[model samples]
Target: MKYANNIAAIDELSASEGVFTTAQAQRLGISRNALSHACKVGRLERVAHGAYRLSGAPSSETDELAAIWKLTASTAFSWERQAKWDGVAVGGSTAAWLLGIGDFHLSPYRIYAPERINSKIESARFGVRNVDEGDMAWMGGLPVTRAERTLADLCLDCEDPSLVEGAFRDAAAQGLIDSTKLGSLLDELGESKRRAALLEPLARALSASDQKGQS
Candidate 1:
């Protein structure tokens, strides 16, 4: 099959690092048949279900992650859901890795969403949780947990408390984490005794640092 290049769609993809979704194409008045024709003619590459990258466009390190995120809301373009993007984001150790604050990586990428996700992909895992807008940040055009929240999640979910401590130190050194904001998150997580037990050491460390600064 032969087709003309969807110049308008390509222009839109260029603005978003050569990535676009089916819904986005439709929004530009390109039909599914047109998109499929573009793919067949080497004008586009389907990266995931409903996600595409312009053919020959430079690939981004975050392309796979971004495509996966788009699947969480296959019907809505990313910019249209800026209010929170359905509360979905990269999270846990994966988030720390993206933020460059930890020497940790999970085999299955960790993603958090407001509701349960039954993903069939072997390389991704999903967790159901509510994330506040303040706890989210942008990285490579995808949403991810901020440093403070990522550390707090590690403190609660990681088996090795030392790993959380190390990540916290790294983030603090890079000025990516605010001690005051972390303190509040710790207090909020401490409401659960089990969580408090896990977070106590970090909380104490933060307190000692505050005291030393005064002295």
Candidate 2:
């Protein structure tokens, strides 16, 4: 409850965002009652059931995001596991990052899990959606659309076309996806005139890269 004690606990929790339950507080030489009292007095704030945050640390946002992801994955209501069960992948943007295709900067952290996974769970947690028909593939124990699928997803969802272009260019340059595959995906999507137009140039760029490799 004391200022110094609260500060020390903040440092400990910052190092590891495990919930500082009453039992853990006892080991820190602080009574459970004292910990509860500190929380009551505004020295700490409970973000989740037992997860506490210091009033001064604004960096809790990232920790909270990570915690939400873990919590969602652990629950029976999770779409992530369902995606696995349905033989769908959980990648695209998230997979692209794993594949070293591009930087992970797109919004909502796109996930390409199975179409059967609960849309509610996806919307509630990571804002996930189905992988477009063309670019679906498996990677790293999860089903994900290919790099081209990832680029197309970004193009559809991103507000900034330039950002999508940048990711497409980076993936193309790295040879992370196939040009013909990307084109096939675009044609399969069949509804997004804007997206098809945007991707056309990037797909050509990838084609050029492939031709250069053959030569």
Candidate 3:
């Protein structure tokens, strides 16, 4: 099959973000060999196995995660997928970093998915969990754990107590999350030592933020 507007079609598939999976290409009737040919001729750049970015497509910070997420749906187009498709979400420290909640520039990108994704990409660590709708948000078409949920999840997974404290303070200070809701969630998570340690600092931070706002 031939497409007169091949690059245009790919642009649409990538949502103008410059990264797409082979499955997306196939949906447009562009075959694996065609993608290879495009790459060989400098029209496309293969970033990962079964993943390609248009050579001329502009770059963005979200490109890497978006590419990997698309691989989760190898044979379906984005619109064809369910509204909360596959229960995939960017969570934990990575979510905090994306939201600029704290000083976190973590590698081995943290992800939450309903099942294990055996992709060739090795730079990510996936946790199997169901992300509730209210606990997640969409950023540039990528699903992410919302601020409260991100911090709550971090409190559970982050090894460094200080990091969680910093994220919690940042989220509270910046009004990125509802302290009341987060407090309830932490309580529901039970009275672990970590939760206890976080609660005191969270109270102090919120108190300071409130005073500053009033002043």
Candidate 4:
């Protein structure tokens, strides 16, 4: 019964996804000593500092998200504790997808942090950057850049304007981005005209949408 309970404890610590952290074991009513013993017995695998995986858990890209959740935020895996997850925000192409405003799938998952994090990861490539946190929000249980911030950053720093424009259209059509908020963000960022120019096509589409609604 005790061993069965330990298994149940491990299941809870992993959030049923089979990934957890050393710090989380204690919080889950399992001692660090027990975790170490589990590791020795091949029940757990240390994936990185304070991060672990069930020995035969299904593999997926989300495992990296689990590791990051450990590093940036507290180990508590409840919605109530998510308030403390201000340390990281998903960014770049990854944010575009997570925000539900783009279809493009690019490599090297990107995350914006208050500061750069040097860490090892498996199953995904990570591009962590210390960047401005103007438009930070949560999507699909992950802290990620808001649509306006994601599109603006793409327009400002990325080499491909066409891709950025497509993402802009998708976000605007879905009402995922607020033009007024985007404008204000650009004003604060400076070079407002230049950046706004990048979104001209989206503006035209919105104008057309407005006219159709009126008609």
Candidate 5:
């Protein structure tokens, strides 16, 4: 089953935004030998120990995040490790920018890494914070915090809520996350009352977008 250029194989590879793992290749009916052959001849480029990228794929900042998924979540590992790390997701203001939701891009992109192994990010600006319930989702092929989660996490990391309100509004207006989900999450906030401010701007932005849409 060496369909290296098979449309389905290519689609599967591209879905990870050009990043894939050995397990992913196997599922795509690409044998390990086929994988080695592809890399040997230049169709794929090996990344790190167990990741590969389609040769000539366009570069992207999300590439780093995608690489994380390939190496961590997608790698072959014990069942316990998979279950434990399933909640890991890229979070904080950097996540907003990564999801095209806001302009709150900061160096050392933050990730909610509860327990990481061999996870040395090359960028100095990349930061890791310990958090529970790191729910994740796909954002244009990158593993990222859910839209609502991203906003909530940003609020915790923000110094001035006013500064990031516009970004929150933009995200809400774009309908990137569900209001109900956000409400539920907010309700769970133990002492972080400041996050409540996000709701107002989100409502206003969604309202404005709705009115504009109708008019």
Candidate 6:
């Protein structure tokens, strides 16, 4: 089966680097076998089972991370699609990036969805956690933990208490999350005593930082 037109279209879109799949080839009026042949001939590079990226494009660590996140979100579980269908937002580490809260330090990007969907999807690719409805909000067209919840989640999982403190301080300084909200999230998370203990101090520090900022 000929794939000259498909190849041309792919090459045009990926002048630098882009991703596509065998299914996409069929959608574009090309044969899957032809697409596979193109990959074998070094015309395409297979990044995952059904995903391919252009060969010889400048790839960076950030690009690799983003690709991993995309793959994990797409294949690791159905919760992501469920969240979209339910009109819930789903983002966490990525949200922190947008909110400028602080660096997430290799933490898995989080997704927030409706309570009805079970959020457990384990993979070596990335971490996924479910947030309650009240704490979920939309960010960049995806559901994510609210700013306060994000800060609390980070505090619960981060290795360095100081980093969590810094994030809380930054979020408060920027007025990205309210101090009262942070306290409430910490309180709500109190069932996990260890987590509450770990984050309470950071919350307090953030309150102090907010005061200093106000002054």
**Best-matching candidate per TM-score:** 1
User: What does the lDDT read for residue 25 in candidate 3?
Assistant: 84
Which structure is stronger by lDDT: 2 or 3?
Answer: 3
Which one wins on lDDT?
Answer: 1
TM-score for every candidate vs. truth? 0.85, 0.47, 0.82, 0.67, 0.58, 0.59
CA displacement after TM-score superposition, residue 205 of candidate 6 (Å): 2.4
Which residue pairs overlap in candidate 5's backbone? 108-125, 108-126
Query: Candidate 3: misplaced stretches above 4 Å?
Result: 3-8, 15-17, 80-82, 191-215
Cα lDDT for residue 108, candidate 4: 55
Q: Better model by TM-score, 5 or 6?
A: 6
Give the better candidate number (4 or 5) by lDDT.
Answer: 4
lDDT of 2 by residue, 99-136 (tens): 56656632244454434334343322243455544456
TM-score quality measure for candidate 2: 0.47
Q: How do all the candidates rank in terms of TM-score, highest first?
A: 1, 3, 4, 6, 5, 2
What is the C-alpha lDDT profile of model 6 across 1-215, one tens digit per residue?
34677777667545522554444545556566766777888877776566566778655433433333344334322234445444334344555665677666333544434344343333222334456666765443334567787777666555466666666667767877776776776777767777767777676786677688799
Q: How high is the lDDT of residue 56 in model 1?
A: 83
Give candidate 1's total backbone clashes. 0
lDDT (Cα, tens digit) per residue for candidate 5, span 1-215: 53646545755665544777777667667677777877887877776556677878776666555556556666443233434555556777767777677777643656666564455666423345444554566566445677777766766665345645666677767777676666666566524455555444544544565687679
Encode model 1's per-residue lDDT on 27-105: one tens digit a residue: 6777888888788888788887778898788887667677778777766767666754578988888898888886888
**Candidate 5 ranges with C-alpha deviation above 4 Å:** 1-17, 22-41, 57-61, 74-85, 114-118, 124-136, 158-160, 177-180, 191-215
How would the candidate models be sorted by lDDT, starting from the highest? Answer: 1, 3, 4, 5, 6, 2
What does candidate 3 score in Cα RMSD to the true structure? 3.3
Worst ten in a row by lDDT for model 5: 75-84
| Residue lDDT tens for model 3, 117-213 | 7765787778876677778877877788988888767756744657777887787767787866776765765376766565555445555666886
